[model samples]
Target: MTLPFFVYGTLRPGETNHDRFLRGRTSSEEPGRLTGSVLYDGPGYPYAVDEPGGVVHGELVTARPGDYRELLAVLDRLEEYAPGDARNLYERVERGVVRARDGLVMQAWVYVAAPPAAARLRAGGRRIEGGDWRIRS
Candidate 1:
């Protein structure tokens, strides 16, 4: 079965690497929100972390089953993120969403920076609301 991915970083469409990775590969894209997290701008890219009252904005992308591996590789490269590094650059986490007003349960893949990494990133970063990347722009 194809996996549903919740992308809050570079993999997000309209961002820098969108055309190179997700342009035509996305079967479906929808506004999705991930709770218990916040966005922090780092030296090179943004990072998310577990924080109460914070929300990470992203798109829910449903990709082809056959494209899973390529998708992972793309994310790994784009985020400069890994699943289980000690630095905790990015770790895949369970994401919960209520699809479009239907309130149906939606679960997908989300990545959060390690708690320590998030700490060193400094504070006062804004939380992304409504799953819109343009909110920061």
Candidate 2:
């Protein structure tokens, strides 16, 4: 089965990690938004956290069945997420993503900061008010 992924940071098209991981592996892609989340600068990267009135601009990508597992594995490694690992940098979870063009909403995998991580990022990371990583200040 194909799987959808909501990517707000490096994995979006034209971003550094996109070509490395998803260039030709995805079946489709479109601009998308993740509501109720905030984006924060993580220096070279960015991180998203759950918030009440936040919206993060991103892209939704569909990975073919044959590429799903491998793609997920690579993403997991890149995000430093190992199932059940206490030190994981990000927690991958399924969340709703709204397509920018048509307003179509769908569930997709998203990486979010855990509570502690969120707190730390909030304390030190610059909030990207527009929620687009490419427009970082």
Whole-model Cα lDDT of every candidate shown, in order = 0.69, 0.89
Residue 43 in candidate 1, Cα distance off native in Å: 3.3
Instruction: For residue 20, give model 1's deviation from the true position in Å.
Output: 1.1
My TM-score estimates for the predictions, one after another, are: 0.78, 0.94
Per-residue CA lDDT of model 2 for 2-110, tens digit only, reads 4599999999899999999998789998999999999998868899998889999999999975888999998999999887888877999899899888898899999
| Top-scoring candidate (lDDT) | 2
Error of 1 at 101 (Å): 4.6
Model number with the top TM-score: 2
Give the lDDT of residue 101 in candidate 1: 51
Candidate 1 Cα lDDT to native: 0.69
Worst 10 residues of 2 by lDDT: 1-10
Q: In model 1, which range of ten residues has the least summed lDDT?
A: 125-134
